[model samples]
Target: MTDLIACTRAEFARLRRWPAFWIILGTWIVLNLVFAYLFNYLAYATGSSMRMSNGQPRAILLQQMLPAAVPEVFTQGMAMFGGALMLVLGALVTGSGYGWGTWKTVFTQGPSRARVAGGTVLALAVVVVALVLTAFVVDTGVAAIIGTVQHQSLALPGAGRSLLGILTGAVILGMWTLAGAVIGVLARGPALAVGLGLVWVLVVENLLRGVASIFAPIRAITDHLPGTAAGSLAGAMRTISGEPTPGVLDILSRPASFVVLAVYIVVFAVAMMWLLHRRDMA
Candidate 1:
């Protein structure tokens, strides 16, 4: 346990200095700022809210920019767009080590492969949690500014609801991060791992879902895919906010979506460990 904790701290320290990590993390934050708040705020100011308000009243555009909407609105990007970026962060976490021979050096220094994998995962989880918390803070701040400037109420989400929303964001982010870690382990380099991960997340999944609509067997399989599960998970809290986002769907029951997402998170974590164990790090 001590070794694992040490490794986790070490991994965290290393990741903090990584430029790619900051780039990807910053991108997610910027995306949240733009799509989640900026775009809607623009629509509200320009009287284009009717067209961009998901078929709701123009007032909803203004309302969504207020503090009470932060919980769900802040998470709208994590479904697919944010998840893809997190995957790249994950790929860099593990795959870049192999590319630079860092893994080989670490293996020679006597830590067990399992310990290193665990450390990587633990550190990644911490990062994921931080991302969610950071988004909540940023979103709430922006929402508050919007509310105050517009003279809208400054009421916030309930403490319990806000906590739950943060947890939901962490879970979604964790699953995709680990999925990227697994690919990083399998590919053994950041470039290929990133390319493959993006291809799967961006191109392949969409194509498969489109095909699945017409083919029954494909539909059955697509229903359980990780992207589908993530989308459903993102949609799980949609009833609370009324914000519509791309890649957020209701294909699975809320319970089923959570279950599937949990399964994928576990599977990817274990797969990452097993892959690191079996492969020659040297």
Candidate 2:
């Protein structure tokens, strides 16, 4: 435990100086801000122009971008960008040890293979949590400002529920981060890990989900994919903001989604540990 803590501190210190960490984090914040602005604009524009079936002006803007709706905005933004950013950062942090030829040096410093691997995972988890919290705070502040300018009520509603959603979304992203750590170890390079992880997330998982929708047999298996499970976990946040639950593709119940996410985290952690123990640093 002492060795693990020491190694974790070293990892954190290294992360403090990592330019990629700040770059990815900065990009995540900026992109989400842009999306928040666009979402508000669309809601306001539609409300100003459209009417309900009863011929009343639609309150689409208030409905979607009210201060009370800030949590929903944050949730959606994290669902879209948080997982991907976590994957990239995870890869960069773990794979860089090899890319910089520091893996062997770290091993020579007296920590067992498991201690080093465990410490790295622990450090990445801390970073993921911090990033998630930062997103919530920044997005909520941006939405509040926008709502104030639009003359909407600035009171946050359902604060408890919104917080629950944020935490759940964070956990899902944390799981993705660990999975990326495994990919980093396997690929042994940041560039390759990021490329492979993105392809898996943006291409393969998406394609599988789409195919699952059209083919009954494929649907059965695709529902069990790690990406689908993560989506299910993140999608649950929508219900807190009174949005419709995600459809057939998720298949798993909320409880089941949590279980699946836990399973994935455990499997990835075990795989990473096994590889670290069995493989040579060089």
Candidate 3:
């Protein structure tokens, strides 16, 4: 336990200084801020000249940008854009170690192979939590600003609901991060793993989803996909707020979404550990 803690700390220390990690994180924050607030605000500002995307009136659009909508804004982008960026971060953090020989050096002579993998994953978990909380805070600030400017009430989302939203974001993002870690270990390089991960997240699953709509039977399998599960979890939060937010789905019940995401995270973590512990580093 002590050794694992030490390993996690070491990994976190290194990741904090990693420019790539910051770049990925920064990108997500900016994307979340823009998509959740900027676009909505712009649409609201356009007034009667433009149609509201969700068919809600301009007033509803403004309400969506108020502080009380923080929980919704916190998770609105997570299913698609946030998850993709996180996968990139995880892939680069783990797979890049191979290209730089960090994994080889550490696994070959430094510590137990399991220990190193555990530490890296534990560290990545921290990154996942950091990303979620950062988004929440930033969205809250922006929403508060908009609320004040528009003279709306600054009331916040319910505490319990907000906590649940945070947990949902962590679960959804955690699954993707671990999936990227496994892919990194599998490909043994950052570029290939990131390419494959992005394709699966951004291209492949989306195409399958379109096909599934045409072939009802395909919906069964697509319903269980990682992206689907992640999107469902985010949608669950939206359900509480009374509408499906952008880039999410309301296909699965909340419990089922949590179960599916938990299963994927475990499978990915186990696969990554097995590959690291048993495969040849050469």
Candidate 4:
């Protein structure tokens, strides 16, 4: 137990010291801010136009941005900003484990292989959870400020649903971070693992969806892809025209995709442990 705690402490300290961590966090914040600003502008413009048509007050403009602010925001924002950013995040978490000969030092700490891997997984999970939640909170707060300043009613009808979406979306992204860690440890070299991890999120997963589109039944297969599955958590849908639409309650209500996400985490964690056991630390 002491060793495990020590490992966790060390992992946490190492991550904090890395420049990549700050870079990824900075990018995530900037992307969200940009989306929030654009959406707010579009919402105000459309709402003002619609209100004039109906002789309603200009305050209706705030409502236009409401959808973008709520359940849809986190998922859409993450899907847009998170793809590359998440890969960068995943890379840093996993990369530090193996990059710069850090893995050797971790293993040499005299803890058993299981303890070492378990500690790393725990540490990564904690960090991912904190990051995703913090990002969502920031998004929500920013939108609230926008609505408030614009004199928009803070009481959007579906605020609870939107909040739930933000949370679930964060968890989904968090799961991917865990999976990335496992892949990183298994691949051993920080650079190769980080490269493959990025490819998995940005290319392979997306390409699978594209291929699935041409085949009729295969389109449903996107429900299994990491990105698509995770998107479901945020209640996001892609139109047949390849446009994004807000997902319905039916999509978000189902819990199966989250289960699959957990499976990914567990399987990779096990794989990481198995690989750690086989490798010689010295």
TM-scores of all candidate predictions against the true structure: 0.95, 0.87, 0.94, 0.77
lDDT of 4 by residue, 95-125 (tens): 5656677677756766877787777778767
Candidate 3 Cα misplacement greater than 4 A, ranges:
48-56, 239-246
- In model 4, pairs of residues that clash are none
lDDT of each: 0.87, 0.73, 0.85, 0.61
Q: How many residue pairs clash in each candidate?
A: 0, 0, 0, 0
> 117-174 in candidate 2: lDDT tens per residue?
8988888878877877787777667767767777778787586967776677677778
Best by lDDT: 1
Top TM-score model = 1
The true-structure Cα RMSD of candidate 3 reads 1.9
Candidate 4 local distance difference test against the native: 0.61
Misplaced by over 4 Å in model 2 are: 42-58, 239-250
Better of 3 and 4 by lDDT: 3
Name the candidate, 2 or 3, with the larger lDDT value. 3
Candidate 3: clashing pairs of residues: none
Worst 10 residues of 2 by lDDT: 49-58
RMSD of each: 1.7, 4.0, 1.9, 5.5
Question: What would the per-residue lDDT of candidate 1 be over residues 107-210, giving only the tens digit for each residue?
Answer: 88958988988999999998999999999999999999999989989999999879878988998899999999999989999999999999999889889999
